[model samples]
Target: MPEVKNEHIKAILAIVPEKPGCYQYFDEKGTIIYVGKAKNLKRRVHSYFNKEQDSNKTKVLVKQIRDIKYIVVDTEEDALLLENNLIKQYRPRYNVLLKDDKTYPCIVIKNEYFPRVFQTRNIIKDGSKYYGPFSSVFMAKTMLQMLRELFPLRTCKLPLTPESIANGNYKVCLEYHIKRCLGPCQGLQTREDYDKNIRIIKEILKGNIAQVSNYLYEEMQQLASNLKFEEAQKIKEKYDIIENYRGKSTIVNHSLTNIDVFSFDETDSSAYINYLHVNNGSIVQGYTFEYKKRLDEAKEELLGLAITEMRTRFNSLAREVIVPFLPDVDMSSTVTFTIPLKGDKRKLLDLSKQNVKQYKLDQLKQAEKLNPEQRTTRVLTTMQHDLQLHALPVHIECFDNSNIQGTNPVASCVVFKMAKPSKKDYRHFHIKTVVGPDDFASMNEVVYRRYRRLLDEEEPLPQLIVIDGGKGQLNAAVDALRSLDLIGKIAIIGIAKRLEELYYPDDPIPLVLDKNSETLKVIQRLRDEAHRFGITFHRSLRSKKQVLSELDSIKGIGEKTKVALLSHFKSVKRIREADQEEIWKVVGVAKGNLVIAGLKQASDKIKESKEK
Candidate 1:
């Protein structure tokens, strides 16, 4: 790499392309410092080396540029699109990054004879039906709970076989005890009954609750007329669940059907936009925006940009968009843009605006909560100056590994968004295809898994990846990213515990924060979170293994019998403490004898081992 200073500006300009594309700015050691897209690559690339016209930002960027790299695209629009992709992939320093990177959970129905409802963040075409891109796991779980209560669906994971169903090999799960499942595992309900309930679940998921309720009412009446009183009562119970949900649905105004409501606010130069997604006359999803720079244009322009971006990214589109202010763009004939006053639309719009207002107030409260001389904020501010970051470090992810003497090795990646912990985005890996406690290999496994998903989904990558060790771990992460073709797209730093040091790629020496520095504290928090997540995951894996190992040695205890016992007692320790009667209750006296022998052997071994 050739250094590009005032003298090399002319030489750099000579090789610049006059086409639309993205460019990379690198330092002397060929480490990328920033990445950006441009309408005219030549002009954009040349601007960096222009000595006469330099602001503080430009000067800092120029000082770091020893080499430049460019990728040519056919059109400026393509360049813009590619730029967003690369910025999201590399998370280069100069790009305007979106702080929100957490994957939203969704309800999925696997395409199977007995379709199971489960939660997932990634949407794959593995023959399954997906219902949402819900913003929160809690919301998705709540919806699933409501569905389970209203419908007699199968929640068992056991494979459905004619023999297993008839012989009662599959035991009803706790969900049946709680009346949330129909216990199809026991073959108590006919296939027709299960299919009928599935139809109702599909209707509810498709926003056809009204139609399903009407159909259920007629069915209930028919059952009563036929003198099937028990069946009628069951139908009546389902109707009550529907009716309860209906009362909550009243909060959504049906008068303004198929509308989107948006609200925008700003605090401390940061702007936020909240979007309320209305479909079939109900608000199904709400999103909040957090951006570094405040909008210089009118509110309408910001709203238009948001709407256009949302439509481009998400599959949901509304017939009308209700905004706090009018949008700057021309509305399509099928779409109406309105500012409602005196109707249900007004109420809906007001509801979105109130959320924005509350969020702005909350931001103020958060700002006030921090000490005026807060160390973390000060360190981040200093880092921004030192490294010339385009924005503050709002979303940071830290990686760490945990293992026991090269066994049960695992790694964890934990995220912190907006200076607050995002527990839902935490990920754990079992160090598959890796052996020993080699920190580098373990870190590599975790990094590859984390970013490979991001690249595949074309989702925005994290703003920063902090390793919990020194340069070795940092280099391992960098190598993993490069393998995924994502190197130079994200900021990488390592926090070494031995000296509380921070190491950046290409920096000859590690940067040590003050012992009590606020920034150092924040890094510590992130490192601690990763450690905690890894340890928790390791403990769960160990407990599961311990129980399985104990059960494996028991005579006449096949996989099914072991599963039955563990499912009933949850742990080997609990099963051992259970008397013969309790053990018989779990499987039967015939199997209980094997469990008793297993317990005695395990206990005797423990005593002998302790004596040794």
Candidate 2:
């Protein structure tokens, strides 16, 4: 491990070409430590080793360079583009990498005769109408539920066929019976009627709500003219549903058609910003991003970087991005960046800034209540420094496993974003490949599956990975990451409860935190959360196994009948108390008779045992 001297810099510069290119610095183990680009490859490459030009950040970069690699390009701009791509791909430790950890579900309508509308995270080339990139899957599903109520859309996965339609073999789902769907599978609605509803849905999603309301009003008039009073009344009910939403829209400005207002503020160690999306003179959506980093740079520079990162991540960039302060750098032509000072635009910017202030206040209050010791924030700050991360670990994820002996092994990954538990991001995994109570192997499988999916999808990966064990568990996670070529890309730590210790890969002894320290408490909180989640999943598995075993002993009860019985009554205790008539109602007469007989025999056996 020889020190990287000026000679190493000269060697790199001598080999570097004059053409525009991107460069990477690798450590001794061939891990990418830093990535950079330059207009003149030789000049930029030499600047790093120049003794007089070195800052602390640059000095750290130089010390990590054991070897250099470069990719030549034709132009400077091309080099810049490639540099961004490579930085994102490798996520070098020193680069100001864009951290996009937020994801939302969208409502997609596929291009087909029977177009399906569903919630999805993926945007593929399968010609579909996507309405949103919504903040959460719950929000997307709520909107979908509302859409189903207004339009009798089909949610069934059954393939369309004339035979199935005529036979009515597929029972109408609860949605259809509750009037949320028109029972299209049962051939209850004509194609003309369904298409009309779908067209209205498309119009609403396209921000053409006035057109949809007007069309519904005209239809209502026609129904009344034809003396179909009942049909006219039904049309009026639909009109009310559309009307109710009209008042929910908050008008930012009467003149502004579509615009986005952005405002940002920063503390010594964190950044907070808000984006307000205004469409059709109304505020449609709002987003807030809390960035964590020491404010070593100017506010203008931070704001510019935040804007660029947001534009790169969010697909729905507004026509104009209104900001409170104008940066010295020139923005690309895709968006018109403006600094509004004196008019309605200025007021909107102020309002967005106020939103940022309120958001920070709310976060502080929440942090106090959630972790009184402020351990969550301290832990995030410590991890950020230890890993030399560009941003603080606002979104921390931890994994734990649970099993009794060698059966019912289950694992869970819980997320804490912004010092709060984001249960929506919590994931549960039933040990798929590994059997028995092997914690190390089970954890390795979980980490591999989770990150592999993220890599394949090109989605944002978590900032940190916390496992629930000591050296073995930490090493297992490291091995999994190495296999995927992502070992150094993510920071991994493990917590074992014996002495309340934290284990890193290179360290032999576990690092124990003071019980009174806020940082230690945060780690304990995350560890406990992972444990709770894993145990909850394991208990559910055990309960399900018990239910299946009990059902297996009964005669004339197969999997389907057992499922139906349990689903209807919800519990075995409830089913045992149900009379013959109630059982018939649950599984229908023919199947119900067999269930009743089995229940009677089981009951008789219990009675005989009691007598003995």
Candidate 3:
């Protein structure tokens, strides 16, 4: 145990109970700054002061604590529940903030004599039942639309008490005339029939459409037995509508009922939880919410917090909760936590995982769209982590060697700053030291030349260097960096074309990154850009060499005379076909005579070789 410097905290620790409950930490100003829960309150609270806190934030939190308060509970489950309530009551600055604050629409069954079903955002405590707190208004409205089509319920707000209806206080409205309502307001529809439809509406909202279908089927059969074919057909239509809707909404086997599924995803600063409520094998509710992490909370703790919040918010009474892993909360004997491995429950878990992943991706995309630099920083950070670099590779350079048939060997260096191409810094190199199509030697020469000049000129060196080759070429480049005493100064990697494998210096085994990862994509782009640049420069050199080769053999016709003739004619063959007078016009008479004679002799030599 560490030394306790604060007498107030030491006194509190001496008498604190070891029971299950929530504890509140208060600053000198008597305001609660943090709230936490634990099974053994004494040990958990003492842990803050007994050790050197690893996180700077935790250290700061401990330094400001002036008082301690707690509420005792019977079990860990009660502790979790009480902690959630207190956190909500007093949103302490150090607790993770639930980022979802939007009030989603819900289908409300208002409390009245003739209860009305409608979509609302406000909740009243007057015995009214709210079904959803749905994630989308469109989903709630779609349910309302289907209910209105299936049953002729009243849409108008009327005081349909027994006294008002008995006194004939209201009249039929346009909805009643159009057959969209049964005119309950005018006392034309019996209370039993109206309430019966409302009961069925509740069943549908609870995701029990099959039970309603069975009831309607039996009613239709009974009506037909009494020789009422028209009424029977109407009931059959209602049954068909429900059956169709159920067919469209059912997601899994019907036996998996009254279950809650939660999948977790997260990043460094935020966590996402996707919740799904399944009833009668159909999803009744699906939502994904985010939490802004205030401390280094584990996935288990954050997931437990989310599960508690979601179940309480939606009033879920599910006995079975499907999770990807066991959360850090005790559910007691009331609820069973299931980590499904296969079957229908597993499908529900997978669906939740998919939703959570997509939600995280959508959030990242939205944040990046708002601030483009965030995306760049995220990509570079990912690269640094994946490549095990000591610092962020803000400036990166990639090199590639290009050649064909041992002709015009060249290398290219493409620069990337902050994960974007810096075209002005792009450079091409001629293979000066290496002869023929020796890629390894060409890489060594260019890599040495590129950095040696940078060191000589005192220019900035790149944080990373990427070579486009396997181990052999990578070793050559590493030797060059070693020669310049730059092995430890800059990070270097080589990419193999066959497998897209990345290799670090002095390591034989390659690092294989995911094909879809952004780090791999950026490295691939740099390699491809260097290859394209080198190939273009190599081709240009080849074309120029072919044109200047034949002219170099003619000595009497000097360089100036050859340039003048070729500049006018555009090619050696064109100059050969031109008359001596045309050549004389481009050059002087002496040079023209000498150039015509040299061309004639070269043409005769080609003819003699072909004849032989």
Candidate 4:
């Protein structure tokens, strides 16, 4: 960390106000070094000079600062928009600059008479109608192709003036012969007919294909009522084509007008935002980009700047913007900022967030393809942040208790290493000294037993321990840790099955993790595995007791032979599956004969009893 030695820096910092606004940092020769938005200008701008920075980049940025400038806004959102505007104007060295962001494909209906409809990547100032900056080029192309199939339009470069066509100077091309185009070149197609086709194409391009389909459907019904069967059939085909195109679109609503959706993610050094431009309920364009921060930037600030740049780049006039946060921007009066709690808008925001995160993950996966350890390291790092854990929980364990009807109670512990299950390390425990299916006691005994043995044998312990229950089971495990003098040495949590909420020690409010977060997924997996292991052990015990009860009535089959039979065959069902020779090998001839006869008499008596 370094300090700004210039006298101009101190005078500027002294007057910075506690207001929401955009701030700029300038270096030697009055070049803007960074642009930022802050809720409180004084606290945000002066913090750079007051505190020691851990990021070397931040330290360097602060040392180079010569003067500060700020423009106050009405709200944080205003600051966001202003900061972005200045960043674009100055392209400050310390600001995050997005490179290689996509400009999505759009359907352009040319302004010329007998206009051509096609897909384009550029938006021109020409008097043409543009629809979509489609989320996918494939989707845009599909719509265009479907339109061409439904209505054969001209793709020619001919100047088909009415006088020239009336003079009969132009000839019909191969397209007209193949029925793929109307022969407007030679006035064979009327201007009225060509313009009608162009109007329908406009509707389809504007994501209003459903309206066209419904209208055609009504027309088909009217024609059919008049007994014009061929006319009805033709209308039906056009209706079906429009309906199919509408069905394939990812549009969520037909009522929604032009809007922009923004979602963002931040790593230590960079921020990524996904932008979706929605027009009349369909996503016209979707783009995601990563911005590498030359200075430490907040997630909100980065997202705000990104939104401004994206909207400006696309020439967007969208008044309503959907975002995860109310950016520090000055659009309070002129534009609407919607932070959707729930609905189609929230879903759209979530979709954008997923896109940005996946885009970032794809970049990482490409860089770390050959080395799997990099992925684990990243996951562990994420878990550490999400859980607020003291250390990365690379080695974690979970315990679960299973019991039914207060009999054959059992517990099991499952371990995970580097976020993957360690099956061989899983252990099942018989509930000892605990009566009447006390889950708390069962959990306590297992935790005490498992960790005590580990300490006695000097086995490596897990960084985190998960209990598959609510607060009671969690506290029981905590008690065991305390008794072992390892309370703070290991981190412990409980997962309540009802809401999947995480319970920590002495904390009143359970930590609510995002459902999509890797930390929650890993903890849930561990809890499920422990339950599976415990239930399997409990079922085995119940089956053993059932077999013992039925076979104990046999007088001649001694306890030694009972053990031998179970040990040899593993279960009573397998013992019953054996033939006389199979039993003979295990118990010797005389005892095997006695055992078979005794089992046969018991079976007969049970059948007779049931029949009676």
Local distance difference test scores for all models: 0.72, 0.73, 0.84, 0.80
lDDT of 2 by residue, 211-234 (tens): 778988999999999999999988
> Which tens-of-lDDT digit does each residue in 1-612 have in candidate 1?
334545444444565667776677777787666877788888888665544543686677777777665655445643544454445546656555431354446577767666788777666667666665443567678888888777757766678766778888878888789877778788877777877777777677655778888998999999999999999998899888887663222232223445777878865567677776665344544556656764466666767778877765656567778887777777677678777885557666766776666556545444544443343465567656544456677678899999988879999999887666899998888888786779898898889988999788887787778899998999999999889887666888999988888998778698876778666777889999999999999999898786598788777789989888878888888888888999998899988998899889988998999999
Candidate 1 deviates by what RMSD? 30.1
Q: Sorted on TM-score, highest at the top, how do the candidates line up?
A: 3, 4, 2, 1
Deviating ranges (above 4 Å) for candidate 2: 1-379, 386-391, 552-579, 598-612
Superposition-based RMSD of candidate 3 using all C-alpha atoms, in angstroms: 17.2
- Top of the candidates by lDDT: 3
RMSD of each: 30.1, 28.8, 17.2, 17.1
Q: Give the per-residue lDDT digits (tens) of candidate 4, residues 1-612.
A: 346577667656655667776787888899989988899998998888888888899989987887776654445643554454456557788788421233456678777767888888776758777765454678778878888888888888776677788899889889999998988888778889999888887777655667787778898999999999999998898888887764322333334668999988877777878887776444545567889999987777887798789988988899999999988667777679999997558766876776676657655654455577887888888988988889899999999999998888889999999999999999999888898979998899999999999999999999999999999999999998999999889999999999999999999899989999888998999998898898988898887678786567767778999999989998766776689899999988888888777777777888999999
lDDT of 2 at 227: 99
Q: Model 3, which residues run further than 4 Å from truth? A: 1-250, 298-301, 308-315, 326-336, 551-570, 579-598, 608-612
lDDT of candidate 3 at residue 405, scale 0 to 100? 89
**Cα lDDT tens digits for candidate 3, 1-612:** 668888767766765677776688999999989988899988999899988999989988998999886655445643554455456657888877421233446688888888899998776668777665443568678878988988998888887799998898999989989999988887889989988998998887766778898999999999999999999999998888898774222143335779999999999999999998876454555668899999999999999999999999999999999999999998867789999997558767887886687668767876776688999999999999999999899999999999898887888999999999999999999888876899899999999999999999999999999999999999999999999999999999999999999999889899999999999999999999999998989889988788876677777777777777777899999988988888888997987787778878888999999999
The residue-level lDDT of candidate 3 at 396 comes to: 100
Which one is best on TM-score? 3
lDDT of 4 at 316: 86
The TM-score, computed over Cα atoms with residue i paired to residue i, of candidate 3 is: 0.54
